[model samples]
Target: MSDPSTASIVSTPRAEQPTETVSPVGAPQGDRKEKPRGLLGDAWLDLRRKPLFWISALFILLFLLMAAFPQLFTSGDAVNGSLDRSLGKPSGDAWFGYDFQGRDVYARVIYGARASIVVSVLSVLGTLLVGGAMGVIAGYRGGWVDAVLSRVADVFFGLPFVLGAIVILTTFNGSGTSNSQWKIMGLVTVSLIVLSWPVVMRLMRSSVLSTKEADYIVAARALGAGTGRIVLKHLLPNCLAPLLVYGTIMVGSFIGAEATLSFLGVGLKSPVVSWGIMISESQSFIRVSPSLLFFPSLFLVLAVLSFVMLGEAVREALDPKLR
Candidate 1:
């Protein structure tokens, strides 16, 4: 019997104590909560602090610009028509001076970057495509498929890199084809790709083999994911870090290899305008004008050093073990 004034206060079911909105497993607790950057993002953050990274980056950018636009760097002609300034020392107007054939060494160095960049980039792309695919197949499929691929890779690995390059270049590019610039560069790029893909294949295969048994990968496989899904969506994203680092390093290696071949009289020949060719032509005149050997060699060394430094920086940033 409640009093009429109280109006029989029906207990309001205790207003069900407000429950914490059941958040998703990893949902942020508050508006100020921060998200983590993944491997690449974190690596980039780490790389930004390194002077070596920026120095290498600047040099690489300089070379890339030099390659993409030689005209912008200098107003003078790359090749001179006369030997009037032959073996001329580097000066104000003629920065790198004239070569034995009266060519502007400065302009030639600028233009030469194009051929090296083109060949290296093309060869790297080709190597990664061929090697990465084979590696993925070998690691994921395993068993007979893995065994067959491994044996093939071993065969290539057993072959000497320099010797293999010589044979391939000589066979593909005969004496008559020396003047054919594109043909020679193409053969060199192809030979490099053929010889280098095995390394990438082994690298990627090992990465995949270690990662395939991981929890996420196992979960993906346990679910309805197909082979293509697992590889394209899961495997590649995780495994490409090593390839990126290696590819950066390999660019320098290939550049050196191309120059070596040219110095040996089989790479980019006369009239093509590459740093290698410049070195090759200047060797005999080392005593006459050391500048001829000095300038091109300097540029080549800078380019190679830049790439190698960049690769090392990236490796340090990406590899937790380094930290």
Candidate 2:
């Protein structure tokens, strides 16, 4: 038997309710507060958790390296193939072998990087500038501006994009004399942009239309944020993810189109070293020295495939629907 007071005290929820204890060794009250996660933190965590992102990043890095350092990897002179060593297969001296003209397959492939990068980068930039602006304007403005721009885009879209590029390059009169390498490249780039803008513009316009109606945009509006501020600061940033994804994909397409044009003799002519030009030059000797076509075509395929993979990876990373 226990004393009543003692019994009452012991039974009074002492065992049922655990006592809260403070330990100096435990996390401090101030230190225990949750820190807000940042965009970088989220992205980093996502990347670590996802395998596709890493694979995509790796390929993108590889292509960037190839594009940046052509001289380091390639052997022999890109332009001057030795006639004496013509039609040689892959040897220690020339890894990719010599072309029909005795040019190092390695050198031409490396130098071809310049043309691939040039056409893709410039064409994508032109697309972004022209299309992105139009999209923002149309999406934000709506009404007459959207109608007119949309109609114009449709008109351009009706034309065959590659054919249009060919026609323009043929007539545009480029920078280089006779061959017109620079001018033809510029012309083709511009023509592609003209046709390409509609796709980007439509994408951007759709993105903006959805983003502009979000709570943040509405809140900004209520807070007296100017149209310019809302657009540039709020809407534009949100639109970038999709645009970047598309832009990456577009690089491959643009490069392929440029190569096709060059192969057809409507693109960069002689004196300019383009993979497409190399392929075109080797068509006759394709049977005699397939190395001429194989190496350049190989590089082209790699470049295009790398970009495509990169774009898909980025899309998976950024798109909530995909995730």
Candidate 3:
């Protein structure tokens, strides 16, 4: 016979005893916090903590504002300059001084943002649309489709970027038609897009190949989802991170390429103020007015650097291996 207290304790129902708090998966609910879901959610959480990401993002926003509204940055005329003030030294009112035409270098630099930013952005978007589509189709339907697309991409990838651009632009620009700024912009945009998309296509193809085999994709297909549904609903989201990272880096490259083409006289010509045009036009007067070259070059370098930094930050954030 046991004591009454011992008997009562022993007689207590097993269900009434205190048990460790268990999660739905049967793991002890200790100090672990719930992690973020999805690629973008995790990347965003990490990006928010990175100072470099914020700084680069802020710079990009400022550049966009300058591109959209040049008037806000400067009231002076970008084109109209006094010959007398040509190569003028920096004054109280004009921080960047004057160009060879005596136009305000500061104003031109501010206005130049529009062309470079617009061209780069448009080219990247074009690349994404054309290249991304091809990549997805090839990746999702392997075999002969992949072979044909891969071969075509390889052909384009073999072309020399600058030389090819020069040939294309010269052919179009010398057709005896009126070379308006808009027309010139279109030609440059087309040339860049044609030459630049191969890289994106290859990246997307590789990413899709690795992602399509994922369990979720397989399950989605098993659940009677159509081809388009599985590709769009399941695969695209997984592949987008790499594309985004590549596109961000490619923006800076496109900007630099545009500048290179412009410097070679095949890019944006006069009347459309671009940093490239400014650099090319000022090379002759580099000895007399170094500021003309200095200011545009500085702005271009800063813009490219900012985009590259932002891309690297995003890549780091998105890579699970980094964590």
- Against the true structure, candidate 2 reaches a TM-score of 0.86
- Give the residue spans of candidate 3 off by over 4 A: 1-36, 175-177
Q: What TM-score, over all chains together, does every model reach? A: 0.89, 0.86, 0.89
How well is each residue in 254-298 modelled by candidate 2, as lDDT tens digits?
A: 888878888988777767777888889889988887878888898
For model 1, residues 1-323, the per-residue Cα lDDT tens digits are 88765663554354565765667877776764557889999899999999999999999999999999878898777755468877888899788788877878888888889998889889999999999999999998999999999999999989998899888877777783534778878888999999989999999999999999999999998998998999999999999999999999989888888888888877777677788888888888989888888888999999999999999999999998996
The Cα local distance difference test for each model comes to: 0.88, 0.82, 0.91
Candidates in descending TM-score order: 3, 1, 2
Candidate number that wins on lDDT, 2 or 3: 3
The collision pairs in model 1 are none
> How many clashes in each structure?
0, 5, 0
Across 1-323, the per-residue lDDT of candidate 3 in tens digits comes to 77999999989999887987657875766677887588888889999999999999999999999999999999999988899987899997788999878899999999999999999999999999899999999998999999999999999999999989989999888742467888888889999999988888998999999999999988988889999899888889879999899899989888899999999888898888999999999999989889889999999998998999999999999998995
